[model samples]
Target: MTLLAVQVLMWIVVGAAATGFASWLAHRSYRRFLRKSRGPVSKSLGRGDVPTKLDTLIDPLEAQFPCQSGLATLLDNADAFAARALSAAQAGRSLDLMYYIWRTDVTGWLLLDALVAAADRGVRVRLLLDDVNVQGFDPAFLALTQHPQIEVRLFNPTRNRGHVVRRTFEMLLGLARFNRRMHGKLWIADGRLAIIGGRNIADTYFATLDADTRNSVDADMLLVGPKVDAVAALFDSYWNLGLSMPILALWPGFKLNRTAFRHRLARHVGSAPSRHYLARTLDSRTPEAVLAGRLHWTDKVQLLADPPDKAYGNHSAAWMSTAIADILTNAQSEVRLITPYFVPGQAGISGLTALAARGVKISLLTNALAATDMLLVYGAYRRYRGALLAAGGSIHEFSPLPKNGRKRDMLHSKVFVIDGRQAIVGSLNFDLRSAFTNTELGLLFEHPTLVADITGMIDALSAPDQAYTVSRPDHALQWTVARPGLPKLMYVEPEASKLQRAISWLVGLLPIQAYL
Candidate 1:
């Protein structure tokens, strides 16, 4: 071999050896961490006795709302914050929360403070969060769990707890196991009142303070009565699953001093921003009305949630997608959908075409390239737009500069309104990830009032200036861009950067379509 060739071969061998050693070290560290932290422990939430005060509080609201059996109230934007915080504060027995993302932002700490108060009042609080979003916030959660009545668990936890190098290594090495996330979001109190929908517990989801704090436009449902019980049962199932690891179990050395911990949390909550939230939440009338004998409730609602082991397989039996499919198939007249990430792979395209063929008027509203948070997802979604439009589907993409002229916000709400009779709302998105990877939950109901309310919201959102309608004029792709007042301007699919378009094109060539 030549001298230069020998040197190049030597470098390749060295690089391979380094890579192999790194992988071996990662595997070894993960195994040791798991071995040290392994344990079997306590029972799940919702098994405790119902509180007397809980019954007393519900009686008056029950009489006022008069929901015969099942009911839900739409909690939009800031009101969602009230629904969640108030539910926790007013709980007399149990408080259970499960979310995919629980950030340590202003909104997050405020809710944490409320849970602390609930725990102080002897309301048993159980918090279950997906581990992906809680990487650096473990110490805060661990401190909160110091309260004797509170327990925090992480679903599908990373084996490398606090070590950054090991964490990244395991995540890269164990992609399949780590990729399937728990996307369901729920907040239930006293097994009587609940809030379930797309809103994660963060300032961005609430957007009460200012436009800068608003990351996306979203919605949640504040539900009371029989529906809450079903939600609690779902929480229990996941809480007891083998995949959930308690906070203390994950880091046993983190000692819990209840008094000191509460004090520190109190100080954190007393910060200026937190105080503002506290004042806003306390003064909010929506929460007062919700807790105090108000809110019209209907009795025609059904809860649908994916099993905790959904990533194992996808079929007609266990996934929320099955339920959603059934709803769409049953729609005879019209179907309207709103999702941030709209990658409806082959099955979705085929199903929608079939529905359109059956004379079902379908309207799809999603985030435009400029309005989407995930460029890769947007690219995946863009590839199917032509096919869907050809199938007689009307597509509207939200504009970055919406009619209400705030900071650019992404579309995060996931809603399915079918036949103007059923409204399905929750954390399930239209992309392949939500369909086949993450666990999802939603409420499907046949209440005319609720359906009309949600449908009206969709109508307003798809109106002239709020979104850009994608049309195929003369069998060519065109965007009817709506400015404030002038006639709609035509462009060749505006609102996306050239770089973004290129990235989308490249993404479409990848073999990860099923996992987008």
Candidate 2:
């Protein structure tokens, strides 16, 4: 009897210990989430500066919906419009443009020529871009800074103008305090219309049939109405506050006048054309108003944003993920996701697993080895092959190198479509870094025809013969299968290479994955 009493006591003690450990772990996890959630972001501008009329601009967004009066999708050539947009600024009463990176490729030239023309015509042009990404920018292109009407600035330009070693260490040690990019890709024209979305200023994004061989698709939106002013204002604030070179500072010998040029350029811009500018514009406000316009949305959707943390009362990443979760949680049928980077941590996998367990079709389309720019990210991504495949999620890898002669292109579009009802394609990546680290943007469209169009475009991209898929049997020993392919297409361990790849890989291995 005494032995029995002791056994019961021991069991009770064990249960308490287990509960304590569980409680401790639960508390730790909760703390971790809180750290990530960080309190709501403060507004960029104080309440005194808040535009009371900004809400009035939202009416244009409504016109974009098919039913509600918002934009459907601009099936136009993004590059051509990009050319027009840059040129339109030459006629600028005022032009504000911002981007993460502006490569000096053919696409860059098209954009640059337009801007220079605008400056020559006398427009007030503000150009803001990420200095880190533009490290190797062409010197000739950099010379364009000498123009009078334009104010060119870097988001966080580094002082180490000499060696790769110093610049790299600066990036690594976090010495580049402002290294965090202004990820917002925006173009505001005369404060009347704007273009915002996932495409940075580059050629791969425009994907012309002539220039694009692989035929990877990307999307952006042209917004008209009151919302544009707010976007324009955001561009202005960042531009005015960002880094600048006082002309003579960068080029003491070339510049003769600053004020005269500014005055003269302003006059020229006034003489440029506005009626000739062309781009798609989206808007519609009330549900009733949408019907009156003969516009119809594929689904009832809400436009949510990070807003200036304090003003919008949400983090950009959380708001975006919640939208994804809402789609996943409420999905009655299938979930189709098209993201360039398919790196999802534990929570993402679990959410996908839950949906798959309930007999829903879950599928993903992302970049293959040859199709990505960040190979290490793909290296990190390859680690989850087993879990994702085990969850009954079928995957397809896109090959940037098309069967045709088109130069291979990384599949850079970010798209999320739920049950064929609604879809989003914009600047947001599925990775955690994009969520918490960068200020991202994208448009969510609700028209079924638009959804179908996006889905169809994805299907065409996936139709290529050589896509990587994770089979259930393969998932059984998937880790082994995923291992061998690393060195072939990825930069897993290392083989010394030229500066670019080597640096990218070393940067990839740093402990600061959260900051990437």
Candidate 3:
């Protein structure tokens, strides 16, 4: 045979073999995943015991003052957002801040200053953070942990001896053990009030930028109400869990005088002041408060909450699945979800399709390609656009705001509003990562005002300047961002560049969905 013919035949054989192997691998993965889901896999968690020292903290925020209960205040941007946060910390008799990431940038330093000031005033303070995201940023926060009244705990920390061994351990264990992130971001003040939302202690979230907002898209909520108790309980669970450590022990040269601040906790009753804030927020005096308002659609508002004890069971991830089911079951008129990541896999796409079959209007708003921080997630998400679009589920992409406008606000809200009347805001996402990997929190409000607010926000976001409408044609996808030359951010099915598509395909083939 001629050499050219032989070479061509060899190439063909190799190509055919590789294609078959890939197909087999995909099938195997599908089978394995289904099996894992069906198996009785017990979750990893330790029981939560009540802290005997709870009485040492005063939380007037929980008092049944002249305010509505569950007075949830949704924050707009980080400038005013930070002010409220810092002031709350300063005013609190006792403060506890838990986070996944608290970088030592402009935002971090400012918050640290506020916490230190609070500590100086004899306020008892505690900070819990995940060590993985800290990288080299520990010293800045660790220094504060040394203060007498302050303590910091690292979550599932890595003993990175700065070697290849660290990489090996991470590879073998798959980091799934540590994939369980403290996605919870809350600030408990005086044990009575707390703020929960998508914002982390970072500059970008604060939105204080130059004329052009860069690295600046984010969202979060400042919560004040009885629900604070449930949130505080979750915090204490993590604090006392093995995954946490007292900040005092993690630092040196610490000097804290918690004596005077400890007394600030109103001992008039067995409950702590922080405890009072939660109760008050839930049962605030305002007749129009979130808790007091009559739900427009009471029966459909199913609250799938992930409390502290949930970590020991299926946790918040399980609750989120139930929430997803709720979205499917109740999305009669229309459904909208705004999540930072939009990596819905086969099951998610199938669920959306089922809803569409029933004539439900479905719309999704997520980061466009250039706007997304997690390209891999966008990649995986790219794979299913065609299927979803065909099923009647529409998609919209929130690009980073124009360079001349306010900083590109990252729509970090984990919100799901159904038929314009029921809504949920929590740490949960539409991806498997949120469903199985991270710790999350959220509340389902059945009030018309709350629902209207969300519906309006989604509607405004779906408009031109904010979000680009995503459409599918001939099973092909299209994106229309306001700025023409910025490169396409959203794709119909999975039409990102070749590199992105390949990256997503590879990740989709792996078991990384649990980690995002």
Measured against the true structure, the TM-scores of the candidates, in listed sequence, are: 0.88, 0.64, 0.71
Model 3 lDDT per residue over 125-228, tens place:
77778766775665555556667666667765544423557545543443334456667677776554456656677656665453343553444444444455
Q: Which ten residues in a row have the lowest lDDT in candidate 3?
A: 39-48
Provide the lDDT at 433 for model 2: 63
Model 3 spans > 4 angstroms off: 1-68, 83-90, 161-174, 210-216, 247-318, 405-409, 481-512
Every candidate's lDDT: 0.79, 0.55, 0.59
Off by over 4 Å in 1: 1-54, 61-67, 256-264, 286-288, 292-294, 311-316, 400-406, 484-487
Off by over 4 Å in 2: 1-92, 138-148, 162-166, 175-179, 208-216, 233-237, 240-328, 400-404, 464-468, 474-516
User: Candidate 3's C-alpha lDDT?
Assistant: 0.59
> Which candidate gets the maximum TM-score versus the true structure?
1
Instruction: Evaluate model 3: give its TM-score.
Output: 0.71
- What are the per-residue Cα lDDT tens digits for candidate 2 across 482-514? 223243333222222455445544654555445
Q: After TM-score superposition, what is the CA distance of residue 437 in candidate 3 from its true location, in Å?
A: 1.3
Across 1-516, the per-residue lDDT of candidate 1 in tens digits comes to 999999999999999898778767865765566556543554334534555455666666777656544454554666678777777777777888899999888888888988988888888888999999998899889988777788898887886678999788778776666788999999888877777889888888887555466467776777777677778778888887667778778786778676776677778788888888668766755445655444446777889899886744445476898788877988899999999888888888889989999999989999887777788887788678888899899999987564355667778999999888888999999988888889999888778767777888788778866788998867787778767553466654466678987898789777677677
State in Å the error of residue 416, model 2: 0.8
